[model samples]
Target: MSLFNGTIQALEHSLGYSSAKNRAISSNLANLDTPNYKAKDVTFKNYLAHEFSRPIQAKTTNSRHIGFQGDTQPAGYKTIINQASSYQHNGNNVDVDKEMADLAENQIYYQALVDRISGKFGSLQTALKGGR
Candidate 1:
């Protein structure tokens, strides 16, 4: 059995998802003034659904063994570009207020995951130290 019982793995995935969303939001904000730039969005529910659909029991015992491909990083998260028309005459679709809100929301989510992972490690360290 794994030491974390998959808690760490789930948390890792969550962190990656939050990070990806943050990057997308950042990118949108960064291009807020660039003409013809479209805004991008990353949805957590889609990421989780994609992650859950993968087989969890499969394992590769050797380099030659067949293993699951992809899903290695936040890149696995779906990023949807806003294709609709923009309010700005320059055709930039990014909304400053929305991107700022998303950034704040993602920061909170990312911090919570980091705290959880830190606590998980702390408990492991305590266990390793005989409850000291």
Candidate 2:
């Protein structure tokens, strides 16, 4: 068992996930008019898996499950592509409004994660300094 806990790890993964989503949204926005450009998306599950090394939907069937420390939820993250079927005249599937909304949401999520991680570190630092 570690001294800190899983909270920091979880927050770090969330930050990474949000950053990835931001990048994906930026890419979609940049290639809005590009022909046949399918918008790529990173699901929340994907980063959850990357963070915890567990599949997001994996159920405990047998005894040899990963991270089977009595935890029930499995873990994994899957990247979805080609979600947009009906494209515009240029065959682009990027939805500007949707992508913008996702971008803003992701930014908020990232900031929250950062703040939590910062607080956790601050607490640890204070502890190290003899609670001064």
Candidate 3:
């Protein structure tokens, strides 16, 4: 038996993705004035796909029961350079407004994940404490 289940692993993967996205957004803001610096973004398609691909474990008493089908492959993030028109004449595509919005969204996502992990650990702690 594993100490941690797939859910914990999935949450860790999501946290990593969020951290990467935050870094990408911070880089874009840092290069807001750099000529020809295209703004980069971490795509969510692969992350969502990975999350949905995890198999749901179920118990069955019959041998003919249909089992859940899913991919066990690990999650990954894709960083893409934005091809949008430059907001300035310096050929830089970093939009402060968009980047700020994205940053706020990512921060919220990160905090939510943290809260989820904390809750999981809290449950475990409670169990270990004999429900006191």
Q: Per-residue lDDT for 17-116 in model 2, tens only?
A: 6777888898999999888898989888544444476434444667787643444432434457875484688778888999989988888888888888
Q: Candidate 1 clashing pairs?
A: none
What residue pairs are clashing in model 2? 46-77, 54-75, 54-76, 55-74, 55-75, 55-76, 56-75, 56-76
Best by TM-score: 3
Which parts of model 3 are misplaced by more than 4 Å? 53-56, 60-70
Give the backbone clash total of model 3.
0
Best by lDDT: 3
State residue 27's C-alpha deviation in candidate 1, in Å: 1.0
lDDT of 2: 0.74
Whole-model lDDT, model 3: 0.87
Clashing pairs in 3: none
Model 3 per-residue lDDT at 52 = 74
Candidate 3 lDDT tens digits, 1-132: 345656798888889889999999999999999999999999879868776767776656688998766546675888999787788899998999999999999999999999999999999999999997
Cα deviation at 28, candidate 2, in Å, is 0.4
Ranked by TM-score, the better of candidates 2 and 3 is 3
| lDDT score at residue 28, model 3, on the 0-100 scale | 99
